[model samples]
Target: ATASLASQGTANIWSCASCHGDKGEGTQTVPRLAGLAPAYLAKQLHDFSKGTRISDSMAYVAKSLSETQITELANYYGAMSSPSGAQPALKGDLARGEKLALSGDYSKNVPACFTCHGTSGIGVGAQFPGLAAQQPAYIAHQLAMWAGGARHNSPLGLMAGIGKALSDEDRRAVADYLASL
Candidate 1:
């Protein structure tokens, strides 16, 4: 499993490490997979393969894997320790971002991200994902995708509505703040 995850095969499949890094630390556009819930990871792989999530690269790679492989990969990454060294990818108002993340704008029906994502944004089981130390570019891109209806994998359109309610500046702020965590 380590070999497969670290090296690409001859069958046109890109190794997970090629993009996500050996320890699943991820890059500017990619997201860290290490320490994610096994269930969440498996669901994402399934979603990518089924088009419930939209990502050309992920979809293609996920489509090539069997269910067993997906589960194995998920388990492997889920049990691994999260790596450090994430950096911010955007500039924004940190104070405003903190307010949004902790209290939100109730007038706009925006719930605090921490309400569902946990106090530190380390995620809530398989339901919400960890936002701490993630790539700001990845976070901002996902928000944009949800806002534009290009991504709809979040349960009950939760993220879609939240994304739509956030202004471009808000998105950047939140992304930057989360990366700081």
Candidate 2:
């Protein structure tokens, strides 16, 4: 097993919670893991292991994990309920994001987001990760990374293409809307 799962059914050794904290509350630099959309989590693990997605250490760590381990972690994290409710304030362009999420611009040739991301961008399936209320900064970073070809782990294996199609504005808009939800 990977170091990530060293504890297994025990309370010793390093568990994901060692750094991430129980309940997925992250420390500085480490990231929260609970309530992450299952699809998103799976993609990230796949990408890291495949060297498509990366972090200074996670790239190697992810690749080292067995498929079973990856699946277990993904399911564990996804099954945990997310922190509920939207953030305190609104932002500059939610209406535009709402438009794109619900109905795309025929002129722009963009498809409606819900078909793939689900009605609320909450996602569905063994791969799709819920996006209802993820942090905007994190979402924006992923979008930027995906656009730059740094992150290609996707539930349907289509994020690279999707990222390619989305402009910076569109990414921002959709990400904003997801955060709103």
Candidate 3:
């Protein structure tokens, strides 16, 4: 599992660690896989394979692996411990972002991000992902993807709707705030 996580073993393939970090800690624009729900990780792998989620790199990587391999990788990352004190990369209105996270704009009819992402945005079971400490670029990019219809793996179009509803500044603010958490 460590070998697979750290290296792809062939020049044609890309290692998970190359993007997600050796300890699954993640870097800018890459999400931390450590301590994520096994089921969530597996589901994302499956979704990547099936095109429900769209990422050119991930699709290629996921398609190269068998289902068993995906499950193994997911479980490996899931069992690992997550590091703390991640820093924010973007500059935005933290107060406004907090309000958006805790209380959605009623005029826009958008629901609070915490409604599904958990009170602290650390995730909710295997359904939602932990937003706290994630990379701002990744979060912002994902929101853009959802808004643009390039990614559609969220349950019932939840992210898509929210992403579409939020202005670019709001998205950045939320991303920055979430990263600060």
Candidate 4:
């Protein structure tokens, strides 16, 4: 259903490939689309449409699309193979990351990463993202954005709160571990 509409062609605002590139390799600013999971792609589209992600470029591009079109676009990009991403690195210590991801700081009463991210960093209900294979740079950027209230895509507004709870060392640890995964 999504494929039929997406590949049919571009719309008035912008063709899906305009920024993502013909094959979804993404530009310097735009992120790669091809090879991304359909689930992740759908969440991003929904976030942009709902004003949660709040990117002027993305919102502008998204405005012309219908809800069905959004789903189709997301599905189109998500279904791609040969996803573009950097190789994971594991230099930072992971003990703290393990604590945050698995049990959190029980003494600090911090919540487990699995509460929102699921057991394997694969995300869960709603629009949470899968963290398994993302690049460390992107992960740190996203986390910082959440902590600073810069990213509005988080529906529950929990990212800022959660991000604030983490120390810099913890963030690095998690990013490193995520790359390793």
Candidate 5:
């Protein structure tokens, strides 16, 4: 049932694979869902449905799903172990990115990505989804959204604050570095 839902979808909704890609590898600006924590996926779907996280396409698709469907889809995608197909598209300072990931700049008050996201950005749990190998454009876009108050579902506004602290160059640098992981 979950497979059908992911690959075929209902008449009212589009298949998850259409945009997220088969095996959940995801393309540019679309998140790779494979191996993400199931609870994180579910929370994101709920956030999209509730408008707390803004993405028109995701909102529409998430709104169409029932709780059961959401669970199934989340589980289906969460169980996948597909390798990332992402390639860096940004021309940012990889050295700075690496520094930011491993040792955050205290003067800027920006925390290391791995502090919450886990070592190597592999993700810690439901609250901190893996950032390694995510699309650079998508990462940068999300940072912009958080900084601009367009996306505010993060815990205690942590992401919003961090996003605000990162400069455009910083965002690109971090994004490119994470994608390289």
Candidate 6:
């Protein structure tokens, strides 16, 4: 039933595959849904529905989903496994990104990405979604949102503080590096 909904949207909604690939790979800035933590996905949907996260399309779709539908969709996407192959178009400094991912610059008050995101940005738990193979554009966009306080659902507002601390170049570098992994 959820698969049907994912593939064929109701009269009022758009199909998930329209923007997210048929395999949930997702296009630039759309976000890959496959293999994500179900709880994380569900939280995002709830955030969108509540307007805590800012995305016009996501808000519309999430608001239309019933609680059961949200759970089903989250589980369906979480069960899917896909290869990571996001190409970087951001032209960020890979070396800097690697350094930031592994060792943050204390001068900037930024914690290492891996501190919460896991060693390789594979995610730590339900709170931190995997960054591996995510679209660089999406990652950059989210960082910007967090920095601007447009999205603030993160735990203890940690992401927002980190986002504000990172320079534009740092954000791009880390985003590109993570996508390449």
Q: What pairs collide in candidate 5?
A: none
On TM-score, the stronger of 2 and 4 is 2
- Candidate 2 stretches greater than 4 Å from native: 1-15, 18-21, 25-32, 36-40, 64-68, 85-92, 155-157
lDDT values of the candidates? Answer: 0.86, 0.65, 0.85, 0.66, 0.91, 0.91
The best-first sequence of candidates by lDDT reads 5, 6, 1, 3, 4, 2
Q: Tens digit of lDDT per residue, candidate 6, span 1-181?
A: 7998899988887889888988999888999999999999999999998878989999999999999999999999999995586877699899999988999889999888999998799987799889988999999999999999889899889899889998999999999999999
Model 4 per-residue lDDT tens digits across residues 126-152: 456666555666666667777776676
Cα lDDT of model 1 by residue, 127-155, tens digit: 89888888888888999999998888999
Candidate 4 Cα outliers beyond 4 Å, as residue runs: 1-40, 81-85, 89-91
The residue pairs found clashing in candidate 2 are: 37-129, 37-130, 39-127, 39-128, 39-129, 49-63
lDDT head-to-head 1 vs 3, winner: 1
Clashing pairs in 3: none
lDDT of 5 by residue, 139-170 (tens): 98899999998899998988998899999999
What are the per-residue Cα lDDT tens digits for candidate 2 across 1-181? 4334733423332466665566664433455566776666777777676777767667756666677878887777877766644341324267877787789766666777777777787777655655566655566567677778777665455666666777777777776776778
**Steric collisions counted per model:** 0, 6, 0, 1, 0, 0
lDDT (tens digit, per residue) of candidate 3 on 22-80: 77888778888888899999999889889988998899988887778788888888888
Candidate 6, pairs of clashing residues:
none
Local error of candidate 3 at 136, Å? 0.9
lDDT pick, better of 2 and 6: 6
lDDT of 4 at 167: 68
True lDDT of residue 124, candidate 3: 94
